[model samples]
Every structure is written in structure tokens, then in C-alpha cells.
Target chain A: MNAFIVIAVCIVFVYTVGFALSLWKQKNKIGAMAVLFLAVIALVLPYFSYFQS
Target chain B: MKQNEGKIGIRDYMAIILLTLGSKVSDDTPTLLYKTAKNSAWISMLGIALLSLIPILFLLKVFSVHRNKNLHEINLHLFGKVMGNLISMGVLLLGFSSFVLDTSVYVDIIGSMYFTRTPTLALYILMLVVCGYGAKRGIESIGSAAWLTLFYLKATLFLALIFAFTKGNLKFIFPLWGPGTLEIAKTTGSKLSIFADFYFLGIIAPLVSSFKEFRKGTLWAFAIVVVEITAALIIFVILFDFTSIEVISYPFHETILYLSIGFLSNVESMFLPFWLVAAFIRFSFYLYLVVTLFGGIFKIKEFEYLVPVFIVIVLFLGIMPKNLTYTLPYLREMILGILSPLFFILPILMWGMAKLRGDFKREAEQSH
Candidate 1:
């Protein structure tokens, strides 16, 4: 479970970063910012979850 | 991609459609089939694929004759300006609402199931952003992504099936026609109309490079998804036994889990990421369609700006129902009762109108 969470989060982080970069390149500022913001939140949320559990 | 200039080939269309339909795996569609049609669920699914073809072929015929017109424009040609715009308005609403519902369902599913302790709202926020980005990239980019994922998607399914065979007991789904033919047919009729979502075919048909590509793409995607789904359910019934099949959530994911348990402590690690990517692309397609169709309806300039707005609407919808159990049946009702038949029969309606007006004859004479 731990290993899976690590790998999954890492994968999401990578993709989210790419998604954000493309949105920026496309001149979709709002989209790029939203994704960057959400990526950070998503990555951080699980630790909060780990503690909750 | 030059195809971004509003043209896509058969392979691009095929990939997009496959990803869109195949990604429904996590929507618990297979489980619904098992429960609704029982051991004959696989066969019932074929019935669905058959049923979908009716509208598909009719629409293709419509496409073949009109050649250049899209669904909305065809509506205008066949129904005349005022009536066409009116019906197009209805289509715009139905397509947008249906896709929003789909996106919401997917968001809710991933959140509740995968990140049990995390906030679904947070997941919804994150996902809608990604979907927005994907939509902004336009359909061509989305199609290209689908094309890239095609190999990985097929290999995953094939691998899952091979593992399923290891412990699969054919008797689990035997007595081949487990449900009465009438019952199976009834389920197929009422529920499978949901597949009428293919009505989007007309909307997307004009975007592809040729009518032939659109037809082949739509039919092949429908056929492949049906076979993949049937194969998944057959394996599901065998692995879990019919007794537990109905109760299982996300049977395809479970099947993946069942196959992966030997090497991985958490089955989801291997499956969920891939499923999520597939789900992401599907959601992006729906998000893009919502913007495109609604923009067409309202004649909104720069519909790309509206992507975030629709994403907000989807998030609201995603959080509307309390949870999955409460929301799914309601969604099914909407699909079976209203959305499917409306969207499904629209092309046929257009075809009939065109025929009545002798539009085909007009086109033939003009060519001569």
C-alpha cells in the first residue's frame, strides 16, 4: 500500500507538471495556474491523509 | 499536428473513440451489465453494440449524402432554419448535460475509491483543471494522446485477461444463456439505449478527414469496446463467481487487482494510474464536446475561455449527489429514460426528414 501510494503520487506529479507546462505554452494562463495549484494540493493532501489514518 | 486545422484520420478517430468508450470500464458499467443481464451480460452487450449500429449506419448514410455538413448544419438543411435551430438547441443541452454527468461520475469514482481519506472536492478541483487543460489543447491533441495510449491500453487488457484465465472457471458463466432471451432483450432495449451516446457520431463525423474514416472509426470503436467489455465481464464472472459479481465495485479494476496481487501489495498501484489516464482522456473529450457543442448552439466566440466555466459546473454536479450508490441509479435512469433515446433517434429523425424532402435526389441531380 505504501509503495503503491508513493508510485501513484509520483506519476501524478509528473503528469500534472507536464499538463501545467503545456497549458502555459498554449497561453492558457488560468488553466496553467489552476493545474499547478492543484498539483501541489494533490501531492500534499495524501500526507495529511497518512496522518489521519 | 496539421490535423489540428480541424481534420483527423480514421486512426485518430478510432483512438479517440476507443479511449472514450473503453475508459468507461471504471464507471462500473461492467458490473451494471452483470447485474442487469446476469450471465448473459456479455451477449447482452453485443446486443448493445448492435443497437448502437442502427443509429451509426443511419448517421453514416446521412454523412455520405451531405458530405460536408455536421450534425447541427444537417439539422438546419433537413429541418429548415427555425426548426433546425430549435432541435439543435435541445441537442446542445443534452450533449453538454450528458458529458457533464459523465465527468462528474468519473471524478467522484476516482476520489472516493482511490483516495479514501482525501477530500473528493480536492480531487474534483484537481481533475477539472487537468480536463480543462486537455480540452484547451483541442481534439487533435486529445486524439494524438489517445493514439499514444492505444498500445498501452490494449496490452493492459490483454495482460489482465491472461491472468484471469489462470483461475477462470468457465462454468461460472455457463448455461450460456443464463437469462431468458426476452429478459436479456428487454434489458438490452431499455438499458443499452444508453449507448445511443453514439449520437455524438454525427457531431464528430464532419471533423474527421472523410466519411469513411468516421464510419469505420465509430463502428470499430463500438465493436472493440463491446468485445473488450464482454471479455472483461466473462472473466469477472469466472474469477469472482456470479454470486459476488453483482456486488463488486469496479469489476474491471478488481480483475486487474486480482491479476496483480502476486507481485504488488496494492493492486491499485499498477492499475489505477493507467485507468486514471484513460479516464482523464475520456473526461477531456467530454469537456471539449461540451464547449464545442454549446458554443455552436450559442454561437459563443472563444469557447476555449468557457472550458473553466463548464469545469466549474461539472464540479458542482460531481458533488451534487451524496455518493456513488445514490448517484449511479439516478444517472442510469437519466441515460435510459431520456438522454439516450433523444440523442439516438435524432439522426434517424434527420434522415427521415431528409428523405421526405427528397434531399438525396436533389443532391444526385445537382451532381449530374
Candidate 2:
């Protein structure tokens, strides 16, 4: 279960970065920056928090 | 009311208010009442309902005189440039904080009970995102969703009630007075935080058609929430008894957990969707209020874009607390101390200012 969640976190982080890059290329600064920022809190924090719980 | 292009009938308005009020019977309220009022928790509820009616009626009277002007517009009219905008901004902040507190409440139950392994912020984000989507859909859509889901919501409540009564003992809620008159009055004043949800009614007042519809819908919605909350408390007391609820944490969840309507072993599972949908309606209603508030405050003709920025702020606020233990009490204080006045006082102050200063007299004369 832990392994699966970790992998899920990695996938989400990767996808968000890719999405952010695409938006950045299109000059959508807010949308692009929000992706990476949200990933840190919403996507990554949950992984460590899972273990902490 | 100036920017509000949305029109909802009495039924839709009733549904929005009902869903907003009913879905809020989550664990926070009953537990707080149990801790405060003991066996006479319902008395505090009665006090809250009665006390709450004063603000609602006064705000309604203000709306009646203003006709089609919402709380924001009324504030602008009554208090003028600086004080009016300041007061409206306070209500706006309260609306944002309300959704944050509410989402955290839902996150508490979902994280501790169902998904022990899931991260709290993830759950918060998921709920907020879904709720934000619904909010972005606009008030008419939210109203329609509330209306659409009203039947299932009612059915779930009925099911929970049947299950609760079947296994509950009414002898538990006896003596008729938990903390007696004075203590209950104090608790009622403090517990008035629960009724702050109804403050949304003032924000959406003008979207409602006709004074008749507004009054009828508001009264009906108020009556429904009062009755429903009173019944929920009664059921909770019957099921959990007195002291058990104080230590148990989620009294309503625990009460409903005992329910098993033959074959439907975990009825809460079935009830979850109904709760989510109704809760989404409630969540989106506040979200809508905040966006409208920004439009009024910033003089922005286009607020559709700011919705996401505000949701980002909600996400930040919702996840700010580490957990429910640290979240509930301080939030209780803030809501009762700050947000309550913002929601309750600002509108009343607007009304009082209008009356004292005769600010709206010119508009009234011109309209006639």
C-alpha cells in the first residue's frame, strides 16, 4: 500500500510539472506556477503524511 | 443584486438553504452541544434557533425595504464609501473562512474514520476542488443541484432517523434542562456559531423573486433547519446518552453508525453520496458568495477568473491546521468572535445606519 501511494505521488508530481511546463510555454504564468505549487502541498505532503499517520 | 443575473424560484431557494443547513449536521455541532449542554443539549439548540431568528428577521426586514438589493449593495447604500466597503469586506472574509472551516470538518471525519492512511490535506484538496467546480458552475446550477439532490437527501435523513429511533432510548434525554436556564442561555450565545450558515441567506436575498417568495422561502427554510437540527440532537441524545458523546468525538457519525436497516449493514456508505452532494451545494453556495463579494469589493466587472485564485486561498486555509484536535476550538472562538459579528452585525448595522441617517430616503422617493 505504501509503495503504491509513493508511486502515485511520483506520477502526480511528474504530470503536474509537465502540465506546468506546457502552460509556461503558452505564457500562462499563474496556471503553470499553480500546478507545481499545488503539487508540493496537495500531492507530495500527503505521501509523507501517509507514513506519519 | 446589481451583478446577479441569477433567478431562482422559491423551491430552489428553499432547497439551497435546506441543503446548506442540513448537510451541516455533521459531527462538529452535536459534539459541541453535548460537551456544552450535556443532556439538555437540545435546549441550547432551541435557544440558538430563537436567537438566530432575530438576526434573520432583521436582515429580512432590511431586504424588504431595499427590494432587490443584496447585503453588499445595501451596505454600500447605508454606510457609504469607506465604512460600507470595509463592512462588506468583513462579510466577504467570513464567507471565505466559512468554507475553510466547513471543509476541515468534513476532512476530519473522512480521514479519521474511513481512510486512516490517507493524508488530511489530500482529502481537503479533493473536496475543495470538487466543491470549487460546483461553485464555478454558478448559483443557478448550484440551486438546481440542490433541488435535484433534495429527495435523496431527505430519504437518507429519514433512513438515519428510523435507524436511530429503532435503537435509541428517549429516557436518556430527560430532566428537560441540561444546564438550567442561565447556563443554557450562555451556551446558546456561544453556540450561535452554528447558525452563521444562514447568513448566506442575506447575501442571496435579492436573487429571490418577490417579497412573498423571499419571506415564505426564508421562513420555511429557517423552520426546516430548526426542526431538523432539533430532531438530530434528540436522536443523538437518545442514542449516545449523556457523557458518552463528550468523549466519543463524532456523535452524529457514531449515532448513524449503529444503523443497519436490515441487509443495509453500513447505511452510512449509502448516505455518503447524498451527504457529499448536499455538502457540495452548501460549499458552492459560500464559494459563490465569496466571488460575488470580490466583484462588489474590487469593482471588477469580471470575477469569473478570480474564482480559482480564491479557491487556492481556501485550499491554503483548509490545510493550515495540522489536525482536527487543534482546529476545532480556536475556529470555534474565531467564528463566534469575529465571523459571527461580520455575518450578523454588518447587515444589522447597515439597517440601523439607514434608519438613523435616512440615507436611502432619496432612493425610496425616487423609486416611487
Candidate 3:
């Protein structure tokens, strides 16, 4: 993976974690979980060679 | 006249419509139309408007009964929880993807056409931040900003078209049916999603002050956008002719570049700010809709909170593709293709569901 892609994924991962924590604090567990799930998918999405195009 | 709190009046609603869909002319939308219908893109636009009427009218009928409910709520009411949420999820996925791809296109436009040296990521972030701020402020703010700037935006656009018309030749529009009758009809069918903005407008349907005003504003905006876009298509064909225009990526920007007002050789700079304002409002509205739908689906009351998360997601996704000029348009065309059928069918389906459940009849009985 390109260094920029790696950094982008890391930034996204951090934002997702922070966001999920905030949502969890606010008692919105569902929203938090949804965010984490989506974030993971989004993070992994770019790495797949099929999607690279 | 006292304005309702948290709701926009007819003029504001119309302004939102005008800015959101009307800005399509300046984007790759005309290119999409020109690709298939060629010089007859305007005819295909008219065909799109005519064909769109059925679904739009059906959507209106559906909204007329569910007066206070937005699209998601209406889906839940008509389709029950499981199915309604499922349908809304599908709509939201399409809507969000469109937002990401469309914003990339605009960012690419800015990067490629105007600011040649600016980094695409930098431009994308700046644009998304402004739009995110607007979206966080909510629809009333977006609508008001749109209404505030509608005049100047349209005026600059009008002047550009007027100048283009003057520079263009009437003879270029000859061989009017550039492809064939069948192709034009097909173009009309496939591009029907050009008016999908109206379907998306259901998210804010209840935000309008009254059903009467919403209906009036919607129809008025629809008529104006059709005429404006069609006239723009005709002028573009006259200016560049079909061959060159079909290949041109962003004709409106190119036209503005080609235009010179008296001694002013470069007028595209003057038009840029207005287009930028319209673009900001357009995405702000789209961002607002996407989060709103996302919130509704997840049972989150304050969907506004999702704005930042989405902004970040969109920014990252938007900048992912290596060659945006080729990639964004391809993704956009695919999205449009998927959305076209859904746009045409969903409203009719909603109306059908409402009819079966006798919601309209109940509305009539209640009204009487």
C-alpha cells in the first residue's frame, strides 16, 4: 500500500474510534457500533486489489 | 407574513431547488446529456422533464397525504418498520455515494480547471469543511443561504450563457438529431435520474411551511430548471457544436473561459465565486440529507452530529481515486444508472403502497 493510503486509513481509524467513544458516552451504543463497523469496512476497502482501480 | 419556526417558506424552498439541481448545468451533467443525445441533449432534457413528471407527481401525491412526514417517515408508515428501514438504507447508500462522487467531481473541476497548482486533497478538505459547517447549521440555514445567493448566481450564469449565445453560430445546431430518435429516447430514459433531486427533496418535504406552498414551489422550480438546463444545452451546442462539446469535460466552465465581456478577456474568474457558492449550498444540502437519512435509519435523534464523521468519510473516499477525471465520471454514471430506475420506480411504489393501504382515502375523509 502507498504511504499516503496507509496514513489515510490510520486517520480514519482514529476518527472512527474517537467517534464511537463519543457515541458510547452519549448512550448511543448502536450508532457507535454502526460507526465502528462502517469504519472498519471503509478502512479495509482500499486495500483490496479489485477496488484499487 | 409570519414565518414558521424551523420551516422554510416557498421562496426559500424554490431557491434550494434552483441551486441544488440547477447547478447541474455547470457540472459534467451536460456532458452526460451531450454524450448520448448529442446536439439533441436539450430535447432529451425536455424528455427527461416530461417523463419525470409521472414519478414526481406520484411522489407529490404521496407527500400530499403524508403532509407532515418526511420521506423516511413515510416509508416507515407505508411499508412497516423492516421494509421501510431497508428501503431507506438503500436510498441513503445511493445518496451518500452520489455525494462522495459528485463532490469529487467538483473538487476535480476546481483542481483541474481553475487552480492548476492547488493540491486536490487541500481543495477537497476546504470545500468539504465549508459545506460541513453549512450542513451542521441545518436546512433552514442552507435554504436561507441559497435564497440569499440565488439571484447573483443565476445572474452570473445568465450573463455567461447570453455571451455564449452571442458568440455561437445558429448553423451549428443543424443535424439536430445528432444520433437518432431511438438514441435520444434512450438517453431520456437513462438520464431520468437527472431529476432525482426532486425525489430526494422528499427528505425536506415537511420542512416547507405548507403542502400547498411546497407543491407550488416544487413545480415552479422544476419548470424553471428544465428550461434553464435545456436553454444551456442549446447554447452550448451552438457555441461548440456537437462534436467538440461531446468531448469537452466541463463546457460551462469552458464557455465562461471562452467568454469576454467587452475588454474583459478572462471572465471565468468572475463567474467562479458564484458557481462555488452554488456548489457549497448544493453539497451542504446533500450532506444534510445524507446524515438525516442515516440518523433516521439508526434511530438517532440528532443526526446533525453525524455530519463530521460523514465529512471525514467523504473527504477520504473522494480523494482515494488516482485519476479522478476518469474515475469519478465512471462511478457517477454507474450511480446515475442505478439511481435512474430507483428514482422512477420508488415514488410510484410508494404511491402504490399508500393506495393499497388507503392512506389517500383516509386523508380525504379527514380533510372533509
Show model 3 residue runs off by greater than 4 Å: A1-28, A39-53, B1-5
lDDT of 2: 0.73
Query: How do the residues B1-368 of candidate 3 rate in per-residue lDDT, one tens digit apiece?
Result: 12223999999999999999999999999999999899999999999999999999999999999999999999999999999999999999998888888898999899999999987767987899899899988888998999999999999999999999999998988787779999999999998999998998999898899999999999999999999999999999999999999889999999999999999999998999989999999999999999888877777766676676687678767878777667777888899899999999999999999999999899899989
lDDT of each: 0.72, 0.73, 0.88
Q: Is candidate 1 or candidate 2 better by lDDT?
A: 2
Query: For residues B72-143, what per-residue lDDT tens digits would candidate 1 score against the true structure?
Result: 778888888889888877876666667766766766667666777877667877888887898888888888
Name the candidate, 1 or 2, with the larger TM-score value: 2
Give the number of the best model, judged by TM-score.
3
Query: For candidate 2, lDDT tens digit of each residue in B49-140?
Result: 88888877777767777787777778887888788788777777666676677777778888887777997767776777787787777778
Reference-based TM-score, model 1? 0.82
Give interface RMSD (Å), model 3.
4.0
Indicate which candidate wins on DockQ: 3
- The best-first sequence of candidates by TM-score reads 3, 2, 1
Q: Determine which window of 10 residues in candidate 2 chain B has minimal summed lDDT.
A: B300-309
Model 1 chain B poorest ten-residue lDDT run: B294-303
Among the numbered candidates, top lDDT falls to 3
